[model samples]
Structures are given as C-alpha cells and as structure tokens.
Target: MKAYFTYSCILLVFVLQACQSNRKTETKNGGIVKYKITGKVDFNDGMQVYLQNYDNELQQFQKTTVKDGEFILEGELVSDGIYNLIVKTDYKDKDTGKKSFRITYPVFLENNCDYEFKVQKYRDGNVIQAAEIITNSEASNNLFVFEKEVAKVKQTWDTRREALSNEAAQLKASLMTIGKGEDSKYNYAIDRMREAGKESQELAKKNPREEVSSLFVNKPEHRTSLITPYLFKYITINENNYARYWTVLDSLDASIQQHPLTIAAKAKVERVKNFYEQMPVFPSITPRNIKGDSLDISKFRDSKLLIIALWSSRDRFSKMDIPTLLNKEPQLKNLGVSVIYLSVEKKFEEWETGNKSLGLGLNSYLLNVTDKDFIVNNYNVSSFPTYIWVEPKSLKIKELRGGDPATPDFLSAIKKAL
Candidate 1:
C-alpha cells in the first residue's frame, strides 16, 4: 500500500522559532513534553544539537546541553516527518586527536506522542561504537541495511584484492619468460603466452558460480566494478537519462585500464563514462511558450534576473512546490525578478490541461520539451523540480538546479538575483 504523509505548517513555525534561539527551553506545549540527553565528553556544559528536515534546511528546534555525562533536551513534537538529528561534541579522539561529533538516525516526532531518544557511545579501550534508538521505523531500516551492506562489501573487497594481486603477479612473471630470448620464435612465444594469460583471466571472470556468490554471500566479496557500473547504466537508460549513463560509462573505461580484470570495478567506471557522453548540448536553444510560440531565452536579455523552473504536470512534487512559488509571484515581481515554467510532458494536450487545471500563473507554459530524457540529456538536470537562474544579458548560467524552490532559501536566491 502507498501512503502520502503530510506535516502541517502551524507546528513548524513554533518549533522553528525555538531552535533559532541561543538558549534551550525546558518546556513546550504548556510543559507537557520534556527530554534529557547525557554523554561523556570534555567540553562546556552546553552543546548545539540540530534538527534538520528533508530539504537540508534547519528547523528552529534544538537541544543545548551535555554535562556530567548526561543532558536534558525538551520540546513538543511539531509534526511527523523525517529528521537527521545531530549532536555536536567538543570531545577529541585520542588517536586522531581531532574533535568530532556524531549523527543520529531519523527521529520521527509524531504529534501528541511524547518521544524520548537515547544516545549512547561506548569505548572499548580505543574503539568507540556510537548508537541511538528512535521510533522512526523507516530511518532505522534504511540505516541498518546501508551500514551492513557497506561494511560487508568493504571487508570482502579488501581480502579478495590481496589474493588476486598475488595471483596476477605470479602469472605475469611466468608468461614473461618467453620474451627472454632475442629470436623471432621467442617473440612469438611471448605473444602466445600473453594471450594464454588473458584467456585464464577471462575464465576467472566467466565463473558464474563465484560471481553469483559475491552478490549474495555473507562472507566472500564477489562483485567487481566491471559489472556494477553497467547495472547502474542500465537503470539510467531505462529512465531515459542517457546523458548520465554516458558519463558513467566513460569513467568506467579508464578504471578498467588500471584495475584490469576486476569486473565489478570496471563496470562502474564505464557506466559513468557512457552517461556523460550521452548528454545533449543546447547552443542558445530557445524555449517555446504554451501557444507554440517560440521564445528565445535571449529575449529576456533586458531583465537582470531570469528564473526557469522545469517540471512535469504528473510530478507530485512539482504540483506542490510550483504552486508555492507562484503564490508569491507578486513579491517576486516587485523585486524585478521574472519567472518561467517549462513542461516536460510528452503530449502538448497533456501540458495544456495540466497547466490550466493547476491554475498556473501567466509566466507558466508548456514548453516544447518532452520528458526528463529530453530535458536531462539536453540540460543535464540531475534532480527533479530543478530551477535554473540565468544572467540573461551575459547569457552565462548563474546557477543550475538552485536551492529547494519550496523553501525560503529559494526566495533568498531570487532576491539576490534582482
């Protein structure tokens, strides 16, 4: 089952204000919810704890204490959403001797739920394992799976590499003996031996049993770059983001020369290299309006600020965030900033109906562009809801894919352009 979760704005304002304060508040929601934190570290009595939302924007709620190996951070839950809770400590490591802090997994704060998250760090002589417990099910699962896979892959790769290096070196030395003599027969033998060695390497790669185990086995590391990059490339190709695929494929080619027979490693480099090569170039390409009227982007040359928002009618995020920007059109216009919407829908009729149903502003249009394939390959868009800021007079791109359009950072960027 699919579900859409919503976090209302009313509670966000109150929580945001408290976090911005230099001091920590011990009470919230008429003192109904309270929290405390404790840790061992050499620092002042107070530390800064940050609560971040998904947009990478900081909210106004924070915890500000870590004294006597314990602390108390109290606040009311504003809404249910994902958050990356971080604790900043001044404790320095004995080995590196560098001061550092740690991050906690997602802490879902449900409304009316008095949530308490415990943070712990244990040191076994010189080793430290930091852990946290929260009620966020999704974050816990994501962190757990990611940590396990990454650790296992690193361990397996390190061990297998040592073994492979020894084998490759031995084979190379054995094959080079044929080249010792100066005669033509010796040169032929050397070439034949080299071919034999490559055949052996290919045999090692074709062993499906070993390769399959590497992907699923709990112990031995099996996946190599030669194979993995292609997997990523396939996904990008399916998404019609050929530009990204070409770039990845090219990078893979260079790595293959260095790593030689490491299939997984080689594959990764090629995927990125291929991704870059597939990207389309736009040489002063003009954008078309909804009425099929071609409007050269250069026509906005007189304006100091030109903001372009690229989105599709079917995209749920665009549906939410685009309207938010348009709602503040009057203020944006007052700052001498101009905005334009470009559609990535396949059909012109789809774009028209979508634009009209959404009640988009005057500046919004269904551009001739269709789908992310055309947009991403041509413009190199890496993420959805991408905003491009252009200095029209100079035709130089000020910034591509600006800040989150739904947040205040986007507004700040627009004001700076004017």
Candidate 2:
C-alpha cells in the first residue's frame, strides 16, 4: 500500500489526549485556558478535523474543514483532560486510483496551551503516526515525553519478540533444508517467545502447536500488541498505563499534580498497584477430572502459565473458548500453558452430562460443591464464563480485563507473564 502523507506534515495520532472541547466555558477550578493548535499539513485542501475525548467518543465542537497545507484550531479547556484531534484526510491513491482511509488520532490536551501537531510515521495505510507532538503546557508536554518513553519500552518489547521469532524461523528453516531434527536453539527460541507473550505470527498460524496460549489467535489483529501510539486514553494500556501515569505524576508541577483529577488518578493508580502487588497466590484446588482421576492444580512448579476457565453447562457462553482450547491443546502446551476447565454447575450429574454433551474433554472437571466456595472466592469468579490467568512461579492472579479484551482494555492484565 502507498503511504498516507509526506514527512513534513505532522501526524497527531496520540495514544491518548483528554478534554479537547470547542466550547468556551469556565471551570470551578478558576483558570480558563485556551488552546492554540496550529500546524502544517500534507494535504492541499478540504481536509476535515474533528475533536474527540479520552472516551473514544467523537465530541465534535464542529465538523471542521480546512485547507491541507496549514491549519489552526482554537479551543478552551478548563483543566488538563484527555482528547484527540482526528484528521480525516481527503487522500487518494495515485497508483491504484483508490480512495484510501479516513484517519484519526488520540492526543492529550491542556488549558492555555500551544500545541504544534506534526505529521510523523505511518502505522499502516489508514493510520498516520505522528513522530512527535510538541506543546507549550508543561503538564501536557510532560505527558508527551512520558508517553514517548513508555512507547519506547513497548516498542522494545515487540522488537525483541519479533527478533526472537525471526531467529527461531531462520533456525527451523535451516534445519528443514538440511532434513534434520529439532535442536536446542529451536526449543530455546520458542521458550523465549512464550515468555514474551506470543510467538511468530506466521509460525503460530501455520502450526496449531505454535500458537499462543490464548488459542485460535490466527487473525492479524491478534498479532499486534500495538506500538506506543495506540488506542489509549487516561488509562493507557491496562497495567502499563498506570505505571506510566505514576511516573509522569511524580514529575508534574506541584499545582498540576495537586489538580483534582490528577489527585484522583494518582490515588486510583496507587490503589490498583497496591492491590495487584498484594494479591495473594491463587489457592490450590484438587478436584476430580472428568476421567474420575484425582488431580491437584498446584503440581506445576515451573514457569508454565495456568489458564483456569470457570464456566457452567447452563451458561452457553461460558464454554465458548473451550473447544478452541481443546483443539489447540498442542498450541497451549507449546506456550507452557495449561487449561483447567472447572464447571460451576450445582449437580455432579449435570457436569457429567454437560461434559458428554459438550465434550468438555479430560481437562474439564466439575467443581466439587464443597470446593465451590473455595474456588469462587479465590479466583474471584463472578461471571459464568470467566478465564482467569494465573501467573507462573508466583502463582498470582492475572484475569482477562479491558472490558471486552477486544477493546483497548482486554488480558490486558496478561501483560503479566503466564
């Protein structure tokens, strides 16, 4: 695909920006600051720019259209808030003669700020990634700097993953060409990638045994853990966002740091961090398998992640990811992950029938009624079909988050290693 824009124009695809309001209003906080957002663009004319807040909702001040080369936007912010100025380029493909994409970005905003939004990098055909966004506001600029720093870490993580995957691929290909068996290097690379959260996308899709423990992640969307410039707002990337937020909060000006929102956010981040850090290891369960064999969940004394799936036969959605897990058992094993399917059914007979009817497999078991309270309380199993990710080594809890996991908020907590 062709590139979206030239290098000179700045792209403002910020991962997060708060409170970009076109309304000229005052706040109870006292100071009413206005924003002067001006920048050069790659377009010629009839380009549209819209305002969006951290919520991902398009709260448009107006349907704005401007000439491509240079543009200026004016807005009032009562305080520092998250928002984005999304630019939908009137662009066309010269080669394919096709109209490409309408692009938008998430950028932060501050009252009384002068922001220079420039075109940066292109993530794909549709999304334009601004290499840099400069602002006069200290608080806002701090966030930009902080985001860049955090993005670097995220990028480094992905790059290492890519490199490991590539090296593993090269080794495997060389072995194949020579008609030889697997070697230590291949196993080492695979283990490293597993530690890094995922393996090579091509390999994962090609062999079920090579896929991530998440299972059935064949789509391209599953490949990208996303670069720094992503879909993030006040809460950046689940657990990642809070750490960065805390880091920036420490560096902000005293008054800005003391701002009501900042205070609340700081408190929340601290609370969350403390809660997770203090989260006790998952209590072990020794339930009977569908095979009528005794099983103890705490036997794995190594670095293999445990994906404990809690579901009921009555709740259809509860067993949704089960078949995929079963079919991709090899894949899970490769990733050093184990699946423990515990049905939260009331009757033992119901679990027996459900397992046969649904073919829940040997890994599936009915949570003993006596053990139900123990499992439910420890795992925090509220809903019917919940997948609890228990961390390896520490045996701490890492649950599926991100409100839908598909959304910006999904295991998201799995940012924690298995």
Candidate 3:
C-alpha cells in the first residue's frame, strides 16, 4: 500500500496556531481509486455542493452543482479518507430578494466506496435546516452518530477558534498596516485578510480533521479542533525541550512578546536577559546525509547563510515546526539561506519514517550518533528542533527561534550580512 502524506496530522497536538501533521489517502500498489457519491437534497435547483478535506488546509476534492433536489459527485480519490460534504444554496424572501445559505457535514470515505447522503427538506424563514447527515458508509454512519452524541457539547476553543484566529489575523494585519494604512498595498492586504477570515470560520464548522482555516492555519488545530488552552500549553511545554527559556523568549519580536496571549507563553521560559552581543563561533564538525554519507561543512561556506536544524521524529515540536519552516522555504531561499535538517533520532528506521511522515524532510540528514556528544556540547543543542544559523566563513553560529529578534533570526541575519 502506498500512503501519501500531508503535513497535517490527526493527533491531539497543534502547531503555532492550529496546524499539525497527517497522512494522506492511500492506495494499494499506486492503483487509482475512485469514489461515487449520489445524494438527494431538499434544497432546490441551482444549489451548489463541494467536497473537501481539512488538513490545516481546505483541500478541495470536488465541486458540483445540484439539480432538481439531487446531485451526483464522482471523482478519483487521490487518496481515501474522510472529507467535508458541503451544501450551499441561494434562497429568496420578501425581506431580501436573495440570500445565501450553507452548512457542512463530515463524511467518511475510502477507495472504491459508494456513499449516499440525504438532506431532508425542512426550512426556517428561507433558511434550510438539517440536523444531521444521512449517509451509507458505515464509518461515516458511526461518525454521524458520534457527532450527534457530542452535538450539544461545545469546547472552550470551539468558541475561541474564531476569536483567536480573528485576533491573530488582525494582529498580522496591524503589523503590515501600522504606518501604511493609506497605501494601496495595505488596502489590498486587508481585503485578502477578510476573505481568509470568512473562509476560516466556515472551515471550522466543516472540517472534522482539525481546526480548518483559510488563512494561516496550524496543524493540530487543522487535524482536530481540540486545541484548548491546556492542550496548547501541553504541546509546547510537555516535550523534552532543552533550549534556554531566554533563547526563545528574546528571539520573539517586542510586540509579540508583549501580546496578551503570548504573555502567558512568556511566563514559562527562563532567559538570560543579556547574552553575548556577538554571534558565537560554531564548532567545526562533519555532517552526514540520510544514507549515512559524509558531508563537509566547508563546501557550504560560500552559501550566504546556512541553517542546520537539529530535530527528532519523536519530538512534538519537530513535527510541527519542521513543516512551518519548510513552508517558508521560498522566502528563505530569496534571502540566500540554505537549510539542512539533521535528525538526532536514536534509530535510523524511525528517522527515515519520521522524514517521510513529516513530508518536509527534503534536505534532511541524520546526525552521527557517535558524534552526538561533541556536537551537542558545542552547539548548545539542548532541545528538539533547534535551528543553528551559521555564517560558515566566519564560523559564527546563532541559535534561532527565540532571540533578540534584531539579528538572531535567519532573515534578520541575512539582511545584516548582505
């Protein structure tokens, strides 16, 4: 069986905001799998329907139109898993000539599966209503039963998803518009943000995989919407982290450090307020690739900036942080910074699996177990997913993530270097 992987996972963990990791649909021997879904809706003709999967991303599977209260959706299941079954239509009333209405349901799917869904006709003031979806797939049927059982229970984050996501988007918008509100660029940015916010809210209801959003969504939140404050803290604090409290703390922007939500995150770390003013010289060492081939750091000295990310597959932060950084690869490349992932996993088998599972292990390599002690000691590698920014020529090393936010991060350092 071949299982393609998505960066989002269906686990009880979240990324910076809500993204996580998950594996994509699978097929045996890479053979194509098709799915057919026929359904009846109480909704009138011209109704619109869509199928999508939420994995920190709203992945559109298929889109079709409804005719005369019935619809048919048949497509190649790029991979088999649960997807969001969305129903939308336009209604007209005396008060308003036309209004739009939409609702979503979670549906389970697999290869060669035939499913049926019925949206019983009912209306409240031009608004169609359906309490639960009627489906044919047993897995989907069981899921509907589970959703009904928990229908009345509202999670704390369930209410907070919209608010926090809004706040985060607003904060980002404020950052870009701080002194450029009158600029056309700022205006365009705000418009896009509004669209993203609206999409995020809708995905939150439709995606059962996690907290889905249109804008910058996090993983755990994407795979599963169970991102309570407690879980947030647990994902960040419960891991085997070894970096200094001040290291990450100082790396954040002054504004972010003081943000109301981040203030709580700030309280957990220990920091050395004033560390060395200069970047420390990196200790020379040999690195190895995934196939246990040797590497010479000298060959990379000509590169403007190099990032050696030390992480482990078993670490939670690695699972989340790796994907996030990889997503920013284009920006990093524009700055002439090259990234190398060095896994310190105990077993090579697990390292290989983790690399595939995370799906962002493009330039990943394995740290020599025999060389672990010396590297760990000199590099200040006390945590999982530590990024070491090296100026190979000068051999100066700056640990990234949380620093002075002035020149500690890769972007800032690249700017200063250039």
Candidate 1, residue 199: CA error in Å? Answer: 70
Indicate which candidate wins on TM-score: 2
Q: Who is ahead in TM-score, 2 or 3?
A: 2
Which 10-residue window of candidate 1 scores lowest in summed lDDT? 22-31
TM-score of each: 0.33, 0.50, 0.34
Better of 1 and 3 by TM-score: 3
lDDT of 1: 0.52
Which of the numbered candidates is closest to the native, going by highest lDDT?
Answer: 3
Q: On residues 1-418, what C-alpha lDDT tens digit does candidate 3 reach at each position?
A: 1232333442323552232122121112222457777877654577777887744335787788878878898788654345687777766554654457887877766443457766555665435576455543334554564455344233543665666576657757676545744666666666767766766665465533222111111322222211111112332331133143334434543323333224443454322222233334665666656665666767777778777777888899888778777776688778777777778888889988998887854377777766666568755678887777776687665444322222336455456545
Instruction: Report how far off residue 175 is in candidate 2 (Å).
Output: 19
Q: Candidate 3, residue 154: CA error in Å?
A: 3.0
Local distance difference test scores for all models: 0.52, 0.56, 0.57
RMSD of each: 23.5, 13.7, 21.0
lDDT of 1 by residue, 293-344 (tens): 6656666777777777887888888888888878776777777667778777
lDDT of 2 at 414: 38
